[model samples]
Target: MLNEHAKLLALFKQTGEIIGRKKLQKMVYIAKKMNLPFNEKYQLHMFGPYSEELSLRVEEVCQLQFVSEVKEKKGGYQQYRYELSEKGEDFLSMMSFHFPDATGMLEDMNHKSSKFLELVSTVLYFEELPKKEVAEKVFKLKAKQNYSEADLDEAYAYINRLHQVAPKKGAYS
Candidate 1:
């Protein structure tokens, strides 16, 4: 079982993935997908181990420059919402950090520069081709060799990992 702090961090990480959306219910749903237990209605003022602590953490995030807050009331319940600010979005964009296997892809590309460049050209031709397509093309190329599926997986994984860190290109802007 995971601790609440870990769960909260997971929630923050998941929430960060959902850019431009400001609905607690949606955030809760995303949290659920991430296997985090989240209460639907949150009371920020009340101090307690669960809801209150969560509220404080949320509030602290909102107090930061990169976060924005919105409030909504429905059926006797108050909901506070948070989204990334432009500055936050810009900060996220400035970060070109890659996920776990990104380095491996860099090395592979370095070793097979022509092949990788060809695949990259294919990727660019589609003009908004999904990461899946890029992975597939690369996989087809790798099939001629004895490479593991790890490279293709890494490509998609890196895309998703980037998504987790920030919004897609032009989404936050």
Candidate 2:
């Protein structure tokens, strides 16, 4: 069994790096993306660390917009999903400042950019919203215009700065 911290890290990544409880429950336990496999995929429900507990922690810590429920199929049940609002991204970046690992920390910063965009893509895919509609929704939720486009550039710049500061391998030869 995966530990709670490992489960959190994996689930956060699996939910397109931003997702809701129902999907998280379904995917986390058996996500092939995370290299976990199980028989009877749909039947594998309730990936432990429980729904209510995870939801509270996610809401308190994750700096993402809490979107409405998602219906998997037409006339099917609705499950909640989250899209990272701009403020949410800001919130995540702020939290990253405290990451304790020094070695390869630059890689983590670089990963954050891709993760943010991936989260946006997840929102578009699950919500069935067109590109423009999703963009508009993100703008409204984050209370900022041009966030998706502009923030990518900002994230890249930070990543580059970190790379410059990281010690170069084999440079002393």
Candidate 3:
């Protein structure tokens, strides 16, 4: 359980500061799908794959001062920015954590808009199905997003690029 927390800490260690709770969630979910070792349980939610376990772990880490969560106003609603506290860095240094070199993949993800990540993760959530089926599901479930074949194609191609970038622990990379 706390081991998972350590991994989250490692993510901050790698990515510096990650903005938005939703981005963090999608980043972890995407990394897990890429065959990295995250064990958060997710359900399909309004945005995409949401992990309550991941959420609680983040909260606990914040309470423990391992991570910092700051709320900021983005347009109409509130947004959260997460970063590794000094305590988090200290704790992570003590753990013998072996993880993929996801720095490139994570930085790539961090550069993307949350909406694009949303579409990417939603595509990944139903990845077990055929491409046609996944596209159909995205069309059905994410009609509000106004995704086109171009978007779906971009998402699929982006998945390949992400897999290649994660490094080691190969499934499809």
lDDT of 2 by residue, 7-100 (tens): 3443343334333454444333223222232111232112222235555545544433422233343346544544444554444444432222
- Which sections of candidate 1 miss by over 4 Å? 1-55, 96-173
Cα deviation of 55 in candidate 1 (Å)?
4.4
**lDDT tens digits by residue: candidate 1, 1-173:** 22332333334333443222223323332233222344434321211112344556555556655567766785697655455566555554455542222233222333333332333333333326666665565456445633345654543453344346443333311
Candidate 3 C-alpha lDDT tens digits along 79-143: 99999999988898888767666787888888888888899999999988999999889989988
Best candidate (score: lDDT): 3
Clashes of each: 0, 2, 0
Point out the worst 10-residue segment of candidate 3 by lDDT. 164-173
TM-score of each: 0.29, 0.30, 0.93
By lDDT: ranked, best first: 3, 1, 2
Model 2 residue 33 distance off true place after TM-score fit, in angstroms: 14
Q: Determine which window of 10 residues in candidate 1 has minimal summed lDDT.
A: 42-51
Point out the higher-scoring one by lDDT: 1 or 3.
3
